[model samples]
Target: MSRLMRISIPTIRVVPQITPGPPPPTVAEAVERVVAFLAPGNVAVLTGAGVSTDSGIRAYRGVEGRYLNPNFKPMFYNDLIEDSPRGHSFRQRYWARSFIGYPRILATRPNPTHAALATLMRTSHVSQLITQNVDGLHHDALRTKDPELHSRILELHGTLHKVHCRAHHTVLRDEYQMQLALLNPYWAELEESFRRTGNKPRTNPDGDVELEGVSFDDFEVPACPECQREGKVEMVMKPEVVFFGETISQQVKDRSYEVIEQADRLLIIGTTLATYSAFRLAKHALELSRPVLLLNLGPTRADGLPQLEKMVVSSGPVLQEAARQLASSRLSEDANLREVLEGGIVTSIEDV
Candidate 1:
């Protein structure tokens, strides 16, 4: 656990400790406009892959987004649920990738952007942090300072930390599936060699990496623990996330709408809003007459929506600089409300 797990109202002295980053001139005008939106201090923040890229995670559609690769095919719920089996090559391939990815994901730390959001939550500028990311870095940052702050964030897509038995609907935490893969003798041997060589194959946004010159057949996979314990066989265990082609739970969708509807404004950070699940939140905010600020490096499905107020092409610098500015500038109700009414909207980076 890092220091970010615990977020609190740090004293004035803390500001001087962390170097204050001025918003880049490229994004200065946009940041100024964006900081205006934060004036109301009841923003519902929606973050996506772009926010985490600074933390070393590649997104699906940025300049380096995985989607642009002609050969890349995202994991689909239908394929995982309907096509793969315990002995199928798909299962073997998934585990192979997990072996490469699990450690990398674990090694990822919350960057300044994540800390910035945590600060916003601490100051109450952000009413709630709604994310399409399942990385859990947001929750991890807020969890340390105040457990209650952790609850204010909603992970629209489930996290990768959990594993579930599709058949039994039982869930386990940590790296159980990966552990099982290691427990298998043959797979374990390959894993050991892969680690010893330090020549990791290329990996994608999904936690799996490529296994060059490796054969998938003859790999043995274990059944889920819950089912195995119950005398059942051939059960499949999957990361308990909302995979592509899957529907988010109705309860989650309703709760998200409730959050968006209640917010004074919506802040979209680091996402293209390509997925309807995330774009719908922006759409709903507009439906409720709420001003929406979308900050991403590229175009989004919400590009033409009249409801969108500001769209910043940058995420980390603007967010970090703005959040830091807000931390020092606004602590009173009047200051917050004043910024809201001033028409602070970041149009696009092109203007700058």
Candidate 2:
């Protein structure tokens, strides 16, 4: 666990030049301007669920609506460890769904936004990407394509594809098999029920599942491996993900702050900066007098902040264009592709 440290600084107001005189700028042009604003070395990127929406994932909240399941609510970390009946039941249904749904999620492909960010990293325009998304799409993108410049990504919300024991803290890459066999022996049957009824279980952005009529008594929660060594083989429980009531470990929070502290400029995309746990870091950046560029469809809580440089647009094209421009300047292959894909010299709405 890392200790908490605060950097005290006053906020400075920066008004970003909003283009309104001409036709709307294409995604590539928007990105070019954003890229030009960022200097080399230690730039920070904060991404949200909107970045993954183009890849088939849905945003939980938006200007038009908030997507939520009426039947399921998130289970907090304290609730699970305290052995609440609802928590146990929730975990059972969650793991049950993971058995059926994990593969479908894994099969999802990265969208233009992800590819663009990867390209930016390759071209040395970005230093670190701090994402609120748990889908692991950024990681997937990196694995598929080896970028020229290495950029580190920090997952603030925790990854969906990982499970860890609360007691021993041993992380599991694919615990669906182990959890299914141990926690809910009848999961297979229940999953069939879901399939037959065409009632797909609802999950939050964090990937926690919700189901009705399930009881904890009918399931077995697994025990920690270390605890089991002492004659207690309890069912090890994997909750949907970090829930609302849970606190992101101090270590994770501190590391995120470190990145904010070192950042010269902050690029915020796809997030509304709604959650305090996630929003506080952006607030910290504002305190340090760092410039923040926001790219999202809806309004953000941080939008009202005096120092935020905001752009109301979809991130998919914005990032793609930015990547294209940065890559073209440095890599010959990227230059050729940029010309073909963009159809001549890319121009911003500001330029037009």
Candidate 3:
């Protein structure tokens, strides 16, 4: 009943770094293993989409990640910055999917993974957190508990809750929400239909959805209002988060280094260090003699790196149990969460 784009294209798949087969062998007693590594305070936690999986969001890469889906093709930064103009709107294909996806993101709450990290931060168990996620769940989780926790966290890819003008470099201080619904009345109607039919589009880790056969012809994409008034740009507004082909700002890159330098160890939670943006931080942390500990479900780019002190693989938010143990042991004299060097690999006291 509403104006609609009539184009239909077959789905495409973007191949991620394929595995050679087999995930990292698990170290038994995963919780104790994690707590052993977490003994050293000033630990810097690097999180990824995996951490937020319990919150109903899926990770982009993992044993069962979207990146591994042969039918999935992520929208790159180049695609967003240089797609069909007008209704395409720097590719409102991106926005169109986001239009269907953002509601779940806005409705999501921090899960146990968040609570674990928050507990670490509040008790000074860790000094800082550098997250590759742009979901802002970390901020949401720690905001009330420790008002200053947001200050100690560095979002490498930025966040989706804010908007910006690609041409004007202007930040739209508003809930990611406005432009899509406001510009495309028809798209909004389609979204409502999806909800009503319980056929809501499938969403990805980054909050972009898969609108299999949807067209973008009549979708009215919004341009940077300020830029449009100044005779620049044609309907392209971007979420603040870094898209696939985008680069993290140098200032952010520098601050990330500063944050990394503040900690003697890097504990990567729920990430594969797949992208250079996320991998580089772990690489940098290693180059400076910082020991890296990987806690993820499958193989990571950093799996066999010599700089890593240890690695643990699990399908779920394994750290929740570890955090609970750490919290419970805070006052118990029977706490034996320290790592003991036996013959070679680090072992917990319970090993003996």
Best model number under lDDT: 3
Per-model CA lDDT versus the true structure:
0.66, 0.63, 0.67
For model 3, what is the C-alpha lDDT against the true structure? 0.67
Best by TM-score: 1
Instruction: Write the number of the candidate with greater TM-score, choosing between 1 and 2.
Output: 1
What tens-digit string does per-residue lDDT give for candidate 1 at 157-208? Answer: 8787777876745555455755666666776666667667765655555566
Per-residue lDDT for 1-352 in model 2, tens only?
Answer: 4544321112211223232323445666676767686645367889988887776665676543243333334445555555666666666555555665554455466677777776565555678888888788777665334343333788877777766666645646465456566556577666666657766655445553445565545555555665567776556456325655566777778889888898788888888776766678888888999887888776566756787777767777666666665566555655534433332222221111
Off by over 4 Å in 2: 1-29, 39-41, 65-72, 84-87, 144-151, 176-186, 189-203, 210-217, 229-231, 333-352
Error of 2 at 245 (Å): 1.3
1-352 per-residue lDDT for model 3 (tens digits): 2211111113332224444544455544667667777777889989987787777776665464336455767666766776455325546677778888887676677766676676667667779998888788888766454457678888888888777776546654344356668878787788788777767566776777877776766666676777767788745667887876576777777887887888988889888666666777788889999878887766676766776854446524456566656666552432221210001121121111
Worst 10 residues of 1 by lDDT: 1-10
Q: Between 2 and 3, whose TM-score is larger?
A: 3
Error (Å) of candidate 3 at residue 282 is: 1.7
Which residue runs does candidate 3 get wrong by more than 4 Å?
1-28, 64-66, 83-90, 143-147, 167-176, 226-234, 315-317, 329-352
